[model samples]
Every structure is written in structure tokens, then in C-alpha cells.
Target: MIPVLALIVGVVLGVILDPTVPAAVEPYLPIAVVAALDAVFGGVRAKLDGIFDDKQFVVSFISNVLVAGLIVWLGDQLGVGGQLSTGVVVVLGVRIFGNVAAIRRHLFRA
Candidate 1:
């Protein structure tokens, strides 16, 4: 339920926003990576936090996002924005299916 609601909210936000908003705001966006990291992390206490301490998780998450962006960027650089978009869509489809399966298994147990 939360996942679906989140998706719906994201879709609505995207639909309502200017398509150029991300680019327009990109220069102003935080470099703090994930929101949770920005919200609760600071000082040596934050450094000792388990989530921040997990180097592998941070690396993996950053790599995944950058790889996806690089894919699109490469495609655009090579005059193939459509190809990059298709690649992004493909990954998104697979992710959505995986999320649905996991939720069904965990929540429905059938």
C-alpha cells in the first residue's frame, strides 16, 4: 500500500511538474545523495551510524544511479536519446516487477 501510494505520488508529481524541472534544479540540488543521508546524518555520531557505516550499500546505490544516468547521457551524446530512454524503461519495468513480486510474497504470503 505504501509502495503503491508512493508510486502514485511520484507519477503525479512528474506529470504536474515541468519536464525541465530536474535539469533546471539540478545545479541547486543537494549533493548529499539520498534524502535519509541528508536528513539525519552529521558529525562523528553520524559517521558511526550503521547506515552511513555501510560503505558497500552507499557505493552500490551511487553506482546504480550514476550508471543509469551515464547510460542516458551516453545515448544522448551519441545521438540516441530514444535508445537511452528505452534502456531506462526496460530497467524500470524489471524493477517494478521485482518489487511487485517481493511485496506479494511478503504481504500476501501466497
Candidate 2:
């Protein structure tokens, strides 16, 4: 509940502030977002499964973003950033979908 409220508030603040990200960090934003979403969904699913842990959630969220960003950064150095970004998104997207499905089943009992 608190996390959901905080997320909503963060989005609202972001929209109102309309902050600009640095140009150098722009390329990694999407990948980072997808990774964060994957973590968020995983956390939610864990909450529903009665296994939620604050430490685990924080670690997962930070590690997901950092690792995804690192992978993209490495790819850029190798001139394969776009491909790696796509791969990260695809993997994270699948995980997000799977988590969503589990959440849905838990919620809807379907």
C-alpha cells in the first residue's frame, strides 16, 4: 500500500517537475526502467506469495538497475549497445509478464 502510494506520488512529481536527464545517461534510461519494472513486479508478486522482504526488494531493485546499466555500458564500449539493450528489454519484459501473470492469478484466483 505504501509502496503503491509512493510510486503514484513519484510519477506525479516527475510529471510536474519534468526533470531532464543528462545526455550521457539518456541511452541507458530505457533499459534501467525495464529492469526496475521487473524488480517492482517481482516484489509485488512476492508480496502476494507471502514472501516479501524489504531487504530483498531493495537489493533486487538496485542490482537490477545497476546490472542492466552495466551491461548496456559494456555493450556500448563494444559497439553493440543497441543489441544488448534489446536483449535486456526482452528478458526483463518476459520476467515482468510472468510476474504479472502470477499476480493476476493470485488476485483473480483464475
Candidate 3:
């Protein structure tokens, strides 16, 4: 409940504020968002399964963002930023979809 509310508030604030990304950090933003969503969906699924841990959720969220950013940064250094960013998105998208599927099953029993 709190997480969902926070998400809503954050989205509302973001829309109202229309924050701009720094040019240097812009390339990694989308990958970080995807990673964060992957962690969020996983946390939600874990909550539904009765195994949600706040500590684990925090760690997962932070680590996902950091690691995804790191991977993109590294790819930039290697001149393969586009490819690595795509890979990160693909992997995280799979995890997000899997978690969402589990959550849907739990919620709807379908």
C-alpha cells in the first residue's frame, strides 16, 4: 500500500515538476528506470507470496539501479553503449514481465 502510494505520488510530482535529466546522465536514465521497475515488480510479487523483506527490497532497488548504470557506463567506455543498453533493457524487461505475471496470478488466481 505504501509503495503503491509512493509510486503514485512520485509520478504525480514528476509530472508536475517536469524535471530535466542532466546531459551527462541522460543516456543511463532509461536503463535505470527499467532496472528499478524490475526490482519494484519483483518486490510486489514477493509481497504477494508472503516473503517481502524491506531490507531486501531496498538493497535490490539500489543495486539494480547502480549495476544497470555501471553496465551502461562501462559500455560507453567500450564504445558499445547502445548494444549493452539494449541488453540491459531486454533482461530487465523479461524479469519485470515475469514478476508481473506472478503478481497477476496471485491477484486473480488465473
Best candidate (score: TM-score)? 2
lDDT of each: 0.50, 0.97, 0.96
lDDT per residue, candidate 1, 71-105, as tens digits? 65666679885676576656555654554555455
Ten residues in a row with the worst lDDT in model 2?
1-10
RMSD of 1: 9.8
Model 2, 1-110: lDDT tens digits are: 89889999999999999999999999999899999999999999999999999999999999999999999999999999999999999999999999999999999998
Q: Model 2, stretches more than 4 Å misplaced?
A: none
lDDT for 109 (candidate 1): 75
TM-score: the better of candidates 2 and 3: 2
Identify the runs in model 1 with alpha carbons over 4 angstroms from their true place. 1-56
* Preferred candidate (TM-score higher): 1 or 2: 2
Give the per-residue Cα lDDT of candidate 3 at 11: 95
Per-candidate TM vs. native? 0.49, 0.97, 0.96
